[model samples]
Target: MIPPRFAVTEDQIAAVVAEFYTCVRQHPGLGPVFAAHVQDWPAHEAKITRFWKNAILFDRGYDGNPLAVHRAAGDVRIPMFDVWLGLFDSVLRRELPSETAAAWSALVHRIGRGLVFGLGQAEGAPPSLR
Candidate 1:
Protein backbone atom coordinates (compact mmCIF):
# COMPACT_ATOMS: atom_id res chain seq x y z
CA MET A 1 0.00 0.00 0.00
CA ILE A 2 1.13 3.56 -0.66
CA PRO A 3 1.11 6.48 1.72
CA PRO A 4 -2.00 8.61 1.96
CA ARG A 5 -2.14 11.74 -0.19
CA PHE A 6 -2.82 13.91 2.81
CA ALA A 7 -3.85 13.87 6.47
CA VAL A 8 -7.39 12.57 6.12
CA THR A 9 -8.55 9.61 8.19
CA GLU A 10 -10.74 6.57 7.61
CA ASP A 11 -13.34 7.97 9.95
CA GLN A 12 -13.38 11.16 7.97
CA ILE A 13 -13.81 9.35 4.70
CA ALA A 14 -16.58 7.15 6.09
CA ALA A 15 -18.38 10.11 7.53
CA VAL A 16 -18.24 11.98 4.26
CA VAL A 17 -19.47 8.98 2.32
CA ALA A 18 -22.40 8.50 4.65
CA GLU A 19 -23.24 12.16 4.69
CA PHE A 20 -23.01 12.47 0.92
CA TYR A 21 -25.26 9.50 0.34
CA THR A 22 -27.77 10.79 2.85
CA CYS A 23 -27.97 13.95 0.85
CA VAL A 24 -28.02 12.05 -2.45
CA ARG A 25 -31.03 10.05 -1.33
CA GLN A 26 -32.88 13.27 -0.70
CA HIS A 27 -31.80 15.20 -3.78
CA PRO A 28 -34.58 15.59 -6.32
CA GLY A 29 -32.28 15.19 -9.31
CA LEU A 30 -29.92 12.54 -8.00
CA GLY A 31 -32.20 10.67 -5.63
CA PRO A 32 -34.17 8.70 -8.18
CA VAL A 33 -31.12 7.97 -10.26
CA PHE A 34 -29.39 6.38 -7.26
CA ALA A 35 -32.43 4.73 -5.70
CA ALA A 36 -33.03 2.83 -8.91
CA HIS A 37 -29.61 1.19 -8.69
CA VAL A 38 -28.82 1.11 -5.01
CA GLN A 39 -30.83 -1.41 -3.11
CA ASP A 40 -28.47 -1.90 -0.14
CA TRP A 41 -27.42 1.43 1.26
CA PRO A 42 -24.98 0.13 3.87
CA ALA A 43 -23.18 -2.16 1.48
CA HIS A 44 -23.04 0.51 -1.17
CA GLU A 45 -21.64 3.05 1.26
CA ALA A 46 -19.04 0.58 2.48
CA LYS A 47 -17.97 -0.16 -1.07
CA ILE A 48 -17.79 3.51 -1.96
CA THR A 49 -15.87 4.27 1.21
CA ARG A 50 -13.34 1.69 0.23
CA PHE A 51 -13.20 3.15 -3.25
CA TRP A 52 -12.41 6.56 -1.79
CA LYS A 53 -9.89 5.12 0.63
CA ASN A 54 -8.17 3.41 -2.25
CA ALA A 55 -8.12 6.62 -4.26
CA ILE A 56 -7.26 9.08 -1.50
CA LEU A 57 -5.18 6.87 0.76
CA PHE A 58 -3.76 4.51 -1.85
CA ASP A 59 -4.99 1.53 0.17
CA ARG A 60 -5.73 -0.46 -2.98
CA GLY A 61 -8.75 -2.05 -1.33
CA TYR A 62 -11.32 -1.28 -4.00
CA ASP A 63 -11.66 -3.50 -7.06
CA GLY A 64 -14.02 -2.02 -9.60
CA ASN A 65 -14.15 0.28 -12.57
CA PRO A 66 -16.17 3.38 -11.75
CA LEU A 67 -16.47 4.43 -15.38
CA ALA A 68 -17.86 1.05 -16.32
CA VAL A 69 -20.22 1.12 -13.39
CA HIS A 70 -21.61 4.46 -14.44
CA ARG A 71 -21.84 3.36 -18.06
CA ALA A 72 -23.78 0.27 -17.10
CA ALA A 73 -26.19 2.34 -15.07
CA GLY A 74 -27.58 3.56 -18.45
CA ASP A 75 -30.04 6.08 -17.11
CA VAL A 76 -27.30 8.30 -15.76
CA ARG A 77 -27.63 11.61 -17.54
CA ILE A 78 -24.78 13.86 -18.65
CA PRO A 79 -26.04 16.69 -16.49
CA MET A 80 -26.08 14.44 -13.44
CA PHE A 81 -22.32 14.55 -13.15
CA ASP A 82 -22.34 18.25 -12.40
CA VAL A 83 -25.12 17.82 -9.84
CA TRP A 84 -23.35 14.88 -8.27
CA LEU A 85 -20.06 16.69 -8.04
CA GLY A 86 -21.70 19.81 -6.71
CA LEU A 87 -23.40 17.77 -4.00
CA PHE A 88 -20.20 15.93 -3.19
CA ASP A 89 -18.24 19.17 -3.06
CA SER A 90 -20.77 20.56 -0.66
CA VAL A 91 -20.37 17.52 1.57
CA LEU A 92 -16.62 17.87 1.49
CA ARG A 93 -16.82 21.47 2.53
CA ARG A 94 -19.13 20.71 5.43
CA GLU A 95 -17.31 17.57 6.56
CA LEU A 96 -13.62 18.38 6.19
CA PRO A 97 -11.07 21.05 6.86
CA SER A 98 -10.56 23.67 4.17
CA GLU A 99 -7.27 22.26 2.88
CA THR A 100 -8.37 18.63 2.90
CA ALA A 101 -11.74 19.46 1.41
CA ALA A 102 -10.15 21.33 -1.46
CA ALA A 103 -7.70 18.52 -2.15
CA TRP A 104 -10.37 15.83 -2.16
CA SER A 105 -12.73 17.98 -4.23
CA ALA A 106 -10.00 18.30 -6.84
CA LEU A 107 -9.68 14.54 -7.01
CA VAL A 108 -13.44 14.02 -7.01
CA HIS A 109 -13.96 16.52 -9.82
CA ARG A 110 -11.22 14.92 -11.87
CA ILE A 111 -12.86 11.52 -11.52
CA GLY A 112 -16.30 13.01 -12.22
CA ARG A 113 -14.98 14.55 -15.44
CA GLY A 114 -13.49 11.24 -16.48
CA LEU A 115 -16.78 9.42 -15.91
CA VAL A 116 -18.66 12.11 -17.82
CA PHE A 117 -16.18 11.93 -20.67
CA GLY A 118 -16.17 8.15 -20.68
CA LEU A 119 -19.95 8.24 -20.86
CA GLY A 120 -19.63 10.30 -24.09
CA GLN A 121 -21.01 13.42 -22.56
CA ALA A 122 -20.05 16.07 -25.10
CA GLU A 123 -21.52 19.14 -23.45
CA GLY A 124 -21.33 20.83 -20.04
CA ALA A 125 -18.03 21.11 -18.22
CA PRO A 126 -17.23 19.73 -14.76
CA PRO A 127 -17.32 22.36 -12.10
CA SER A 128 -14.02 23.73 -10.79
CA LEU A 129 -12.84 23.48 -7.19
CA ARG A 130 -14.98 25.74 -5.04
Candidate 2:
Protein backbone atom coordinates (compact mmCIF):
# COMPACT_ATOMS: atom_id res chain seq x y z
CA MET A 1 0.00 0.00 0.00
CA ILE A 2 1.18 3.56 -0.68
CA PRO A 3 1.74 5.99 2.15
CA PRO A 4 -0.41 9.10 2.30
CA ARG A 5 1.52 12.20 1.40
CA PHE A 6 1.34 15.42 3.37
CA ALA A 7 1.49 17.52 0.26
CA VAL A 8 -1.70 18.53 -1.53
CA THR A 9 -1.62 17.32 -5.13
CA GLU A 10 -2.54 19.31 -8.24
CA ASP A 11 -5.91 17.61 -8.39
CA GLN A 12 -6.52 18.34 -4.72
CA ILE A 13 -5.62 21.95 -5.32
CA ALA A 14 -8.06 22.16 -8.17
CA ALA A 15 -10.79 20.61 -6.09
CA VAL A 16 -10.11 22.96 -3.21
CA VAL A 17 -10.24 25.97 -5.51
CA ALA A 18 -13.49 24.86 -7.08
CA GLU A 19 -15.06 24.04 -3.74
CA PHE A 20 -13.85 27.26 -2.23
CA TYR A 21 -15.46 29.40 -4.92
CA THR A 22 -18.64 27.42 -4.77
CA CYS A 23 -18.82 27.87 -1.02
CA VAL A 24 -17.99 31.54 -1.38
CA ARG A 25 -20.78 31.98 -3.88
CA GLN A 26 -23.22 30.38 -1.54
CA HIS A 27 -22.11 32.04 1.68
CA PRO A 28 -24.46 34.82 2.66
CA GLY A 29 -21.84 37.23 3.96
CA LEU A 30 -19.37 36.59 1.19
CA GLY A 31 -21.57 35.99 -1.85
CA PRO A 32 -22.33 39.54 -2.82
CA VAL A 33 -18.76 40.65 -2.29
CA PHE A 34 -17.57 37.79 -4.47
CA ALA A 35 -20.12 38.45 -7.19
CA ALA A 36 -19.22 42.12 -7.30
CA HIS A 37 -15.43 41.80 -7.31
CA VAL A 38 -14.79 38.53 -9.04
CA GLN A 39 -16.05 39.60 -12.47
CA ASP A 40 -13.71 37.25 -14.39
CA TRP A 41 -13.71 34.01 -12.45
CA PRO A 42 -11.83 31.81 -14.88
CA ALA A 43 -8.66 33.80 -14.52
CA HIS A 44 -9.20 34.10 -10.79
CA GLU A 45 -9.75 30.36 -10.63
CA ALA A 46 -6.46 29.71 -12.40
CA LYS A 47 -4.71 32.17 -10.14
CA ILE A 48 -6.01 30.45 -6.99
CA THR A 49 -4.98 27.11 -8.47
CA ARG A 50 -1.48 28.43 -8.87
CA PHE A 51 -1.56 30.01 -5.44
CA TRP A 52 -2.50 26.85 -3.55
CA LYS A 53 -0.37 24.66 -5.77
CA ASN A 54 2.68 26.77 -5.04
CA ALA A 55 1.79 27.15 -1.38
CA ILE A 56 1.55 23.40 -0.88
CA LEU A 57 4.09 22.24 -3.48
CA PHE A 58 6.77 24.89 -2.86
CA ASP A 59 6.73 25.60 -6.59
CA ARG A 60 7.41 28.98 -8.21
CA GLY A 61 4.32 29.14 -10.41
CA TYR A 62 2.12 31.57 -8.49
CA ASP A 63 2.73 35.29 -9.02
CA GLY A 64 -0.39 37.17 -8.09
CA ASN A 65 -0.70 39.28 -4.95
CA PRO A 66 -3.64 38.13 -2.84
CA LEU A 67 -3.45 41.27 -0.79
CA ALA A 68 -3.65 43.49 -3.82
CA VAL A 69 -6.52 41.51 -5.22
CA HIS A 70 -8.50 41.87 -2.02
CA ARG A 71 -7.63 45.53 -1.78
CA ALA A 72 -8.90 46.14 -5.26
CA ALA A 73 -12.08 44.39 -4.20
CA GLY A 74 -13.64 47.18 -2.19
CA ASP A 75 -16.76 45.14 -1.61
CA VAL A 76 -15.32 43.10 1.22
CA ARG A 77 -16.70 44.38 4.50
CA ILE A 78 -15.14 43.92 7.93
CA PRO A 79 -17.15 40.82 8.84
CA MET A 80 -16.68 39.12 5.49
CA PHE A 81 -13.19 37.92 6.30
CA ASP A 82 -14.41 35.87 9.23
CA VAL A 83 -17.33 34.61 7.18
CA TRP A 84 -14.99 33.56 4.41
CA LEU A 85 -12.76 31.77 6.86
CA GLY A 86 -15.72 29.91 8.29
CA LEU A 87 -16.80 28.78 4.83
CA PHE A 88 -13.27 27.69 3.99
CA ASP A 89 -13.04 25.74 7.21
CA SER A 90 -16.40 24.16 6.56
CA VAL A 91 -15.34 23.02 3.11
CA LEU A 92 -12.02 21.70 4.37
CA ARG A 93 -13.61 19.81 7.23
CA ARG A 94 -16.11 18.21 4.91
CA GLU A 95 -13.50 17.09 2.39
CA LEU A 96 -10.41 15.94 4.28
CA PRO A 97 -9.70 13.25 6.84
CA SER A 98 -9.37 14.18 10.50
CA GLU A 99 -5.60 14.54 10.72
CA THR A 100 -5.01 16.19 7.35
CA ALA A 101 -8.11 18.27 7.86
CA ALA A 102 -6.85 19.55 11.19
CA ALA A 103 -3.53 20.59 9.73
CA TRP A 104 -5.06 22.36 6.78
CA SER A 105 -7.65 23.95 9.02
CA ALA A 106 -5.00 25.46 11.25
CA LEU A 107 -2.94 26.56 8.27
CA VAL A 108 -5.84 28.25 6.50
CA HIS A 109 -7.01 30.01 9.65
CA ARG A 110 -3.57 31.29 10.48
CA ILE A 111 -2.87 32.45 6.95
CA GLY A 112 -6.31 33.97 6.46
CA ARG A 113 -6.14 35.90 9.71
CA GLY A 114 -2.64 37.05 8.97
CA LEU A 115 -3.56 38.27 5.54
CA VAL A 116 -6.67 40.09 6.68
CA PHE A 117 -4.95 41.65 9.67
CA GLY A 118 -1.92 42.59 7.63
CA LEU A 119 -4.10 44.25 5.06
CA GLY A 120 -5.86 46.12 7.82
CA GLN A 121 -2.56 47.36 9.14
CA ALA A 122 -1.41 48.40 5.69
CA GLU A 123 -4.59 50.34 5.20
CA GLY A 124 -4.00 52.28 8.43
CA ALA A 125 -6.93 50.70 10.21
CA PRO A 126 -6.95 49.95 13.92
CA PRO A 127 -5.07 46.79 14.83
CA SER A 128 -6.99 43.75 13.61
CA LEU A 129 -4.33 41.39 14.83
CA ARG A 130 -6.64 39.17 16.77
Candidate 3:
Protein backbone atom coordinates (compact mmCIF):
# COMPACT_ATOMS: atom_id res chain seq x y z
CA MET A 1 0.00 0.00 0.00
CA ILE A 2 1.15 3.47 -0.73
CA PRO A 3 1.94 5.68 2.22
CA PRO A 4 -0.47 8.50 2.91
CA ARG A 5 0.79 11.85 1.72
CA PHE A 6 0.18 14.92 3.81
CA ALA A 7 -1.38 17.84 1.97
CA VAL A 8 0.82 20.71 3.07
CA THR A 9 -0.80 24.11 2.67
CA GLU A 10 0.66 27.61 2.41
CA ASP A 11 -0.68 28.53 5.82
CA GLN A 12 1.01 25.52 7.36
CA ILE A 13 4.29 26.33 5.70
CA ALA A 14 4.11 29.95 6.78
CA ALA A 15 3.41 29.03 10.36
CA VAL A 16 6.26 26.55 10.42
CA VAL A 17 8.71 29.06 8.98
CA ALA A 18 7.62 31.76 11.39
CA GLU A 19 7.85 29.55 14.43
CA PHE A 20 11.15 28.05 13.32
CA TYR A 21 12.73 31.48 12.92
CA THR A 22 11.41 32.56 16.27
CA CYS A 23 13.27 29.65 17.81
CA VAL A 24 16.36 30.42 15.76
CA ARG A 25 16.36 34.05 16.76
CA GLN A 26 16.26 33.03 20.39
CA HIS A 27 18.82 30.29 20.13
CA PRO A 28 22.15 30.99 21.82
CA GLY A 29 24.54 29.82 19.11
CA LEU A 30 22.49 30.25 15.95
CA GLY A 31 20.93 33.57 16.90
CA PRO A 32 24.09 35.65 16.60
CA VAL A 33 25.11 34.03 13.35
CA PHE A 34 21.74 34.75 11.75
CA ALA A 35 21.66 38.29 13.11
CA ALA A 36 25.02 39.02 11.54
CA HIS A 37 23.61 38.32 8.08
CA VAL A 38 19.90 39.01 8.37
CA GLN A 39 19.40 42.60 9.42
CA ASP A 40 15.68 42.66 8.62
CA TRP A 41 13.64 39.91 10.16
CA PRO A 42 10.40 40.70 8.37
CA ALA A 43 11.99 40.66 4.93
CA HIS A 44 14.00 37.58 5.69
CA GLU A 45 10.91 35.80 6.95
CA ALA A 46 9.00 36.71 3.84
CA LYS A 47 11.77 35.43 1.62
CA ILE A 48 12.04 32.22 3.56
CA THR A 49 8.28 31.76 3.47
CA ARG A 50 8.43 31.98 -0.29
CA PHE A 51 11.34 29.60 -0.31
CA TRP A 52 9.43 27.01 1.66
CA LYS A 53 6.32 27.43 -0.43
CA ASN A 54 8.35 26.81 -3.54
CA ALA A 55 10.24 23.94 -2.01
CA ILE A 56 7.31 22.09 -0.50
CA LEU A 57 4.52 23.05 -2.88
CA PHE A 58 6.32 23.78 -6.16
CA ASP A 59 4.61 27.17 -6.17
CA ARG A 60 7.42 28.82 -8.15
CA GLY A 61 7.44 31.78 -5.80
CA TYR A 62 11.09 31.70 -4.83
CA ASP A 63 14.00 32.34 -7.17
CA GLY A 64 17.03 32.99 -5.01
CA ASN A 65 20.24 31.02 -5.13
CA PRO A 66 20.46 29.80 -1.56
CA LEU A 67 23.72 27.92 -2.02
CA ALA A 68 25.39 30.96 -3.48
CA VAL A 69 24.01 33.16 -0.74
CA HIS A 70 25.25 30.85 1.98
CA ARG A 71 28.64 30.53 0.32
CA ALA A 72 28.97 34.28 0.10
CA ALA A 73 28.06 34.67 3.73
CA GLY A 74 31.55 33.25 4.42
CA ASP A 75 31.10 32.62 8.11
CA VAL A 76 28.75 29.65 8.26
CA ARG A 77 30.34 26.59 9.79
CA ILE A 78 29.67 22.84 9.61
CA PRO A 79 28.50 22.52 13.18
CA MET A 80 26.07 25.35 12.66
CA PHE A 81 24.12 23.11 10.33
CA ASP A 82 23.64 20.77 13.23
CA VAL A 83 22.21 23.51 15.36
CA TRP A 84 19.98 24.77 12.58
CA LEU A 85 18.61 21.36 11.77
CA GLY A 86 18.13 20.54 15.43
CA LEU A 87 16.09 23.65 16.02
CA PHE A 88 14.16 23.19 12.79
CA ASP A 89 13.27 19.64 13.78
CA SER A 90 12.12 20.79 17.15
CA VAL A 91 9.86 23.53 15.86
CA LEU A 92 8.47 21.46 13.03
CA ARG A 93 7.61 18.59 15.31
CA ARG A 94 6.01 20.91 17.77
CA GLU A 95 3.98 22.99 15.34
CA LEU A 96 3.08 20.44 12.69
CA PRO A 97 1.66 16.99 12.44
CA SER A 98 4.06 14.08 12.49
CA GLU A 99 3.71 13.39 8.78
CA THR A 100 4.24 17.01 7.88
CA ALA A 101 7.14 17.35 10.25
CA ALA A 102 8.82 14.24 8.86
CA ALA A 103 8.42 15.43 5.28
CA TRP A 104 9.85 18.85 5.98
CA SER A 105 12.62 17.42 8.13
CA ALA A 106 13.76 15.13 5.34
CA LEU A 107 13.85 17.93 2.82
CA VAL A 108 15.60 20.33 5.20
CA HIS A 109 18.23 17.72 6.04
CA ARG A 110 18.91 17.17 2.36
CA ILE A 111 19.24 20.90 1.81
CA GLY A 112 21.49 21.30 4.82
CA ARG A 113 23.77 18.49 3.68
CA GLY A 114 23.93 19.95 0.20
CA LEU A 115 24.81 23.35 1.62
CA VAL A 116 27.53 21.84 3.75
CA PHE A 117 28.93 19.99 0.74
CA GLY A 118 28.83 23.10 -1.41
CA LEU A 119 30.62 25.07 1.30
CA GLY A 120 33.43 22.50 1.26
CA GLN A 121 32.85 21.62 4.86
CA ALA A 122 31.23 18.21 4.50
CA GLU A 123 34.32 16.63 5.95
CA GLY A 124 33.75 18.50 9.20
CA ALA A 125 36.17 21.36 8.53
CA PRO A 126 34.87 24.71 9.73
CA PRO A 127 34.48 27.34 7.04
CA SER A 128 36.69 29.78 8.92
CA LEU A 129 39.58 27.35 8.74
CA ARG A 130 38.98 26.41 5.13
Reference-based lDDT, each prediction: 0.91, 0.74, 0.85
Q: Comparing candidate 1 with candidate 2, which one achieves the higher TM-score?
A: 1
Looking at candidate 3, what is the lDDT of residue 82? Answer: 89
lDDT of 2 by residue, 49-75 (tens): 888766666666898878767777776
Write model 1 residue lDDT over 1-130, tens digit each, in one string: 5778888999999999999999999999899999999999999999999999999998877999887788888899888998999999999999999999999999999998788777884335564444
> By TM-score, highest first, what's the ranking?
1, 3, 2
lDDT by residue (20-119, candidate 3, tens digit) is: 9899889999888899999999899999999987777777779898888887787888789988999999989998889889988999999998888877
Which candidate tops lDDT? 1
Give the least accurate 10-residue stretch of model 3, judged by summed lDDT. Answer: 121-130
Clash list (residue pairs), candidate 1: none
Total backbone collisions for each predicted model: 0, 0, 0
**Candidate 3 lDDT:** 0.85
